[model samples]
Target: MDQWIKTILEEFGAIGVGALMLLENVFPPIPSELVMPWAGYSVSQGKSSFLAIVSAGSAGSFAGAWAWFWFARRIGKERLANWVDAHGAWLTITRDDIERVDHWFNDWGAAAVLLCRMIPGLRTLISVPAGFANMPPEKFSVYTGIGTVAWTALLAAVGLWLGKNYGDLARPLSWVSTAVIACLFSIWVYRLVQQRRTGSPHKVR
Candidate 1:
């Protein structure tokens, strides 16, 4: 997968960065951790400019997040809530879990959108809550843009700093990614155990 990502960035330049970011946002399994840094390393190698890679990556992430927000908006809150209530267990997310996010969005508004884009797991899922809350598209764009640019720039910069050493650091970065995934899995397990002990507010159908 790492080699595949590197090849795309090598062959397609900034466009490949944008495309990968879009897919990453829509499908959370695609790691931006890998994409942004690789693109940055490419820039260091003079394959592309810093501004172009960052801009394309940010644009792609924004578009992918918008896609989810738009879809959730079309679904509407009640129907989505009902679906979640029935089947959220498989995803380890309940309607109540969603409602907590909704409340957090209500409390934090645009800040919530901006900050979440930088978070690994929350980056993509945050869009759904925003959609459910019917946050104005323009507002979403402003915050999401700010957040994605900051995030893309940060990761790309890390790669740029690493330069030729980026290859050496790849294994360490993979381990970090693995640790992140493990932590997320642990959180899910904790949630599941808690749910069993206390019972969910809404019974899964």
Candidate 2:
């Protein structure tokens, strides 16, 4: 993974950042933690502009979000739920989180879509619930666009600052990002385990 990221940084640079962000949103396994920082470092190296990199990343994120939203809208809740139950591993969604998201979507309406994008793991997954709830297309796009751009810009800034200390920062930044990803995955796994053991649902909101 490290070698792959380094290669992308060396070759495509900021464009790689955008592509990876899109993939990250659509696929979840592609870590934006690594991509954003690399883009930041590239900016520091004068390889790319920070604003441009953020824009590309945000665009990719929006595309991914839209894809999920459309899927939800088309499939409807019962069908999507059955499909998720059959192929749960690939989806990475929990019944509890789904229930909670549904409740929030019902209570908050279109506003929940914007708020959900601000949360870490919830950002991409929220689109699914929004779609299922039949959120207005224009509203979803507007809120998602605002949130995606803000989040991407924030991460890019962090990357740019780390890039300033390129020699000393690279190793530490790599470790930090790795640790964060590991922790997040661990939490997700732990939640799954707890859900299984206790047969309790996850609550959203």
Q: How far is candidate 2 from the true structure (C-alpha RMSD, Å)?
A: 3.4
- State the C-alpha lDDT per candidate: 0.85, 0.77
- Superposition TM-score, candidate 2 onto the true structure: 0.86
In the range 60-127, model 1's lDDT, one tens digit per residue, is: 99999999899889998778778878877756778877778788888988899999999987898789
Q: After TM-score superposition, what is the CA distance of residue 127 in candidate 1 from its true location, in Å?
A: 1.8
lDDT of 2 by residue, 1-205 (tens): 5457757866886677778888888877666777777777778878888888898888988898999999989988777666556556434565555668788788987777777776777788889889997888998999999988888888889878877865446677778767877887787787678667765333321
TM-score of each: 0.82, 0.86
Off by over 4 Å in 2: 89-92, 165-168, 195-205
Name the 10 consecutive residues with the lowest summed lDDT in model 2: 196-205
Q: Which residue pairs collide, candidate 2?
A: 96-202, 100-204
Instruction: Indicate the worst ten consecutive residues by lDDT in candidate 1.
Output: 165-174
Cα lDDT for residue 149, model 2?
A: 86
